[model samples]
Target: MATSFIVVLLFIALVGYTRLAEAVSENPTASQIRFLLDEDAALRQKLHTRIQGLRQSVSTLNASIVPCSCPLPTTPAPRTQVSYTGTLKSTMSSLNAASVFNFTGDLINVGAPYTPHDAHFVAPVSGIYGFSLAAYMSPRYYVYIDLLKENAPILHVKTGHYYSGSTNRQVNLGTNFVLTNMTKGDHVWAKYSGGSAYLFGEGVSTFSGFLLYEL
Candidate 1:
């Protein structure tokens, strides 16, 4: 009976040993579990580094981009302004019949629209213009000058004896501020009235004009 009992106890011990060996094989070792945790931690750090690098690249690109907020330069328009001033150098006396006065001296002739040869101002462009003239006479002489546009007169200026009796007096007659609208190629000149008329020169007699604005 003692031998049989000892044999049964040995069989129970062998069965328990087999079950413990299977449990150890089915579960993992401590070293394997630690290695798996370390590998997982390294992968998470790499993923975090890649995400930070992408964020930095996006920030750098945004900083390098330039904003289009500054205003651009604009071109200016063209300007057109023409002017002329002329005078006579010598005296004009005894004008027989109505005739155009010729200006021989020039102070300012911009654009060369006024010519001494033609003694007229031809319009270079269509615009409103302002013209002026000053005439000087000595003693009891009478003078009549007209601002002529084409063949007809537009403005008249006359200087006569302001005082009665024969007195030696010098007088200045001026046609100031005659504004007229002129087209291109139109002519403007000064005409002297017929008969005995005298005009003093030496820059005292002047003719000036300017283009006010374009049409």
Candidate 2:
């Protein structure tokens, strides 16, 4: 009987020990190291989430606006008005034998020396002005005439009516082609087509004027 009782007591002690071990394994505080590791993992996750939010906020702030180095340049507006470019023929007198129609179409006598002359002009307004001249020819005489800019001859049209015919009557002398190269205060005039060609106008005068243009 005593032997049987001792064996039963030993078996009961072993079963109690096994139950205690299982309870200890389920209890988090029993292994303080494992409990701290879980807390550390949670802290790391929170820190990572905060950092990601901060980074996203910083990126959002950077994308809020655009930057530039310098401002755009301004341009000036154009002026509106007619600007004169041709030589101004000045004469207070009428076209006579001496002046020989030494005048512009408006009766302004483009006076004397009968050489190339520059006209003083002001840009009436900012614009590109064209200048041109018309040369009338006489059929009876061989005439050599030219248009000049600042005394530099540009146009030269001559007729050999005298050499080709003997009539004192006016023949197909010639007329000037169109010229538009003009600028404000750019003097324009005409001269003797400097040569042996003996050519003269009906009024014994030549002329030049400005032609202003715009699109």
Candidate 3:
């Protein structure tokens, strides 16, 4: 801004000097020359005072500005991912009531929540979870399986038996899923509820669960 003001002042001074030179060349009068010089000096003094005022205004504006005092935006921490998958490796026949089916083969345990040693998935954090239980039975035999949470039944599934007089005794698969909320240290597992038959394993039965979201 100051540079532009100086350029405009120089242009005005040049025009005034050119007009004064033309007047002196035409009239050749000392009084007229002195009057033009005085007018030019007054105009220059007025412009210089205006420029000083503009500089003082710019300095005051710069001093009055304040930097932002508010805090910067923050990033949230990442969420914990919890999930597990296990399968029964051996078949169990003639199972007693409330028998817990241990899935010793652990395929995926992301947060180490599921313990295949005790067939229990202990929750590591409070959240909503989705559990799935699948069971396969031998031909001509069926069993009722229950998905339990801390020894209480939450979901039940049963395999179908082979029909009578059928040449082939076809095996049936039983599967069920339950969505439940669990707190930290809560237990979840599968149990054989009641049936004449038992659970068929050898990778045919599975138990899996995953945390949908945290509370």
Better of 1 and 2 by lDDT: 1
For residues 113-148, write the lDDT of model 1, one tens digit per residue: 797776899888899988998886665676878888
Question: Model 3: per-residue lDDT, tens digit, 133-176?
Answer: 99888666878888889889998888857554855445489888
The most accurate candidate by TM-score is 3
Model 3 poorest 10 in a row by lDDT: 162-171
The sequence of per-residue lDDT tens digits that candidate 2 reaches over residues 66-181 is 89868798786653444222222432222221222233333332222122233322323234544444444344445555656566666666653455365353445354554445
User: lDDT per prediction?
Assistant: 0.74, 0.45, 0.84
Candidate 3 regions exceeding 4 Å error are 1-47, 63-67, 97-100, 104-106, 162-171
| Models sorted by lDDT, best on top | 3, 1, 2
RMSD, model 3, all Cα superposed? 4.4
- Measured on C-alpha atoms, candidate 3 has an lDDT of 0.84
State the lDDT at 209 in candidate 3: 91
Evaluate model 1: give its TM-score: 0.61
> After superposing candidate 1, which stretches have Cα over 4 Å from the reference?
1-77, 162-171
